[model samples]
Target: MDLTINDRVLVVFAEKAELPVAELDLDQTFEEIGLDSLHLMEVALWVQKEYGAVIPEGDLHHEQTVREALAYLDARTR
Candidate 1:
């Protein structure tokens, strides 16, 4: 999906991440940014509040990287 200006997924991801927003190259994969599982959970919680959806605990547990977590959120949002 094309990221909307106020896309909460991107918002929370960017806010919690250590990198500057301008540096989050869209061409790069989320894994390349190096956010750990704990931070992923922080993003997930933000997703839940922002999008108002439930992310399954099982899937969240197995999501080992940022890319995987993005895919999980994408599926949930759609």
Candidate 2:
């Protein structure tokens, strides 16, 4: 399995939030980026599709940051 975490996830997120990639703070919460639960659900679904990991929607609440989401998906996909 190619375990590389796709950068496209972040790119799509940035685009959805109407922000530049450089402005994204990996440590910041999704709400801080002008995103809400709906956006997080989209991201969770995206990760499931791209990484072949079945991430539960409830798990999104635990992943408060981009770094956390990436890390969670990386572990599950691996």
lDDT values for all models: 0.59, 0.76
* Per-model TM against the reference: 0.58, 0.79
Best candidate, lDDT: 2
Cα TM-score of candidate 2: 0.79
Q: Tell me the tens digit of each residue's lDDT in model 2 across 1-78.
A: 542574777787798789998998899877778888887788778877876788887786634787886677668877
Runs in model 2 lying further than 4 Å from the true structure: 1-3
Cα lDDT of model 1 overall? Answer: 0.59
